[model samples]
Target: MKHYPVGVFCDFDGTISKSDLIASIAYEFAGQAGRDLVRRIQRRELSVREGVEAIFRAIPSARLPEITSYTEQLTVVREGFDQLVSGCIQRGWLFAVVSGGLDIFVHPVVQAYRSEIEVFCNHLDASGEYLSIEWDVTCDDLCDGGCGLCKPTVLRRFKPDNDVQVVIGDGVTDLKAAKEADYVFARDSLLRVCREQGIACTPFESLAEVIPTLEQEVSL
Candidate 1:
């Protein structure tokens, strides 16, 4: 085993949480319209930002509080999240939660680890008739647009020269980030996409599985 600095970029929606938060919110509040939009996103017919915006737009701005409350109730942090964070800290590895989800929901769920890890995500505005997304990050020249927070951009920004870049994700949004990483821990759709793309990666169902794989590689 060799020792080197490693940067871990993890997805939030389906990876850290037990389920996809945005999709859940959309289905619960936005109704059938939301389901259709989500399907379009899955099919790559619509950009992620477009699908998310369309879904939230269908829900009136007045329901923001209800949406937030619902999000909190629905959020269940996946097992081994804390351990993954701790492993990164102990080994002096850089760890970031790079989510395409909105801040309103992403914040509340990851509040416990706020001070420990860096988080990059989009913001939601409920000042108008419907919810609108505000982006702090956009796709770079290396990538085509669609990603709201742009995980690959964040991975490039945080991963230093000579350091190994590891990406962990479970959805379509994680695909681009996986391409940019030196190592990828993928599950579900992301795993399928990676295999299809012929990108070498480790398949994992839990963050716990990721920890030992990383530790073993870095000799930590």
Candidate 2:
């Protein structure tokens, strides 16, 4: 059997948690009008970028930090994620978080598992109680999809010459990276995209389901 260096990249929002933290924050801070806008974007009736901008615009000028604090309180890490991350680190695997979500939300989660993972995400700018987004889309120039952070580009950059690359995600934005990875653990929108696009992927409900499969792959 061959032993290859392995790198694991995961999406933060719906993948690692039961809900989308940023979306929850938007709902709380931006109120009903903002929630309506989010629905439109999710339905593809509006561009995601435009929808996000609208949400931020609707967010009040006094609840930004409060919303941030609320997010920290509401966010829950997925079951068994800590064990999966620990297992990977124990085996000397390189783990990274590649998320389109804001850094404010991603930071705390990554910090919880700090010694084992690194995070790359978009930044947020908040003044008083209003917020603006700083998108990291430069990686998209290398690919056709106008992704927020261009997950595939991040994979290509950090991909090891001697090991297989693995990506775990659950949305359309994750599809590009899923295609680029040697192994893709997909669910939700990403799984649907893979099926429609005829991309081979392993569907998983959680990281717990992925750990054993990865262990077998690495061992072999």
Candidate 3:
């Protein structure tokens, strides 16, 4: 058994939640045009920031609140999330959500987790049903990684003294952080990226799969 100092940073949308809440909102609220833009972004034909801005711009203002409310009602936690989170807390592991998704969509999940986790995500500005994003311009301009919220930089700032960093995620935006982390648990796009890039990572289908390994590491 081996013990290592640990700090955990997790991606929110698809990693902790069963599906990508922000994407669901985009397709539902932004309609066809917005979905098309997102597809382009996913294919790398458009930058994430540009694509997100364009999609939001195409959506009618009245749909924002509806989307927000609908997302709060519809988002589902990934199976075994609460157990994993509770286990990490009990082990005294520092936990944080490092998401490129917007705060409006991520908030409900955070509330569900209560004071158990801290979040770093993009903020959305809404007046009634209209919505706009408040980009973390100060952080973005300094880091310049093209993420809606730069997860790696946030993790660095949040745990400057941490000796062992673990990043868990399921998307392309997670690549940078995976590179920086001491250990990584990857799935979906992030897993593919790790494979292609030859980055060492443990692959898992869900957070449930991650917990046992984490418990073992902490116990050691």
Q: Which pairs clash inside model 2?
A: none
| After superposition, candidate 3 runs with Cα above 4 Å error | 1-4, 112-114, 128-130, 136-144, 215-220
Give the Å shift of residue 48 in candidate 3: 1.9
lDDT of 2 by residue, 128-161 (tens): 4567777775455668654666788888877654
Cα error of candidate 1 at position 60, Å: 0.8
Winner of 1 and 3 under lDDT: 1
Q: Model 3, residue 204: what's the lDDT?
A: 83
lDDT (CA) per prediction = 0.85, 0.77, 0.75
What's the number of clashes in each of the models? 0, 0, 0
Off by over 4 Å in 1: 1-4, 218-220
Candidate 2 deviation (Cα RMSD) = 3.4
Best by lDDT: 1
The superposed Cα distance between candidate 1 and the true structure at residue 84, in angstroms, equals 0.5
Q: Residues 1-220, candidate 3, lDDT per residue (tens digit)?
A: 1232567888888988767876777788778887887788778787667777776766666776787788788777787677777766787666778887777777777776657666777887665345677775224444655666777777667556566788999888788789888789998988988999999999887577776886676443
TM-score of 1: 0.93
Q: Per-residue alpha-carbon lDDT of model 1 for 1-220, expressed as tens digits?
A: 2333888889999999888999998899988888899899999999888888888778889999998888888888888888898888777777788999889878886788788778899888999988888986898888888786788888777655427888999999899999999899999999999999999889887788887887687543
Model 1, position 72: C-alpha lDDT score? 83
RMSD values, in order shown: 2.9, 3.4, 3.7
Q: Against the hidden reference, what TM-scores do the models get?
A: 0.93, 0.85, 0.86
Task: Please report, as a residue range, the 10-residue window in candidate 1 with the lowest summed lDDT.
Answer: 154-163
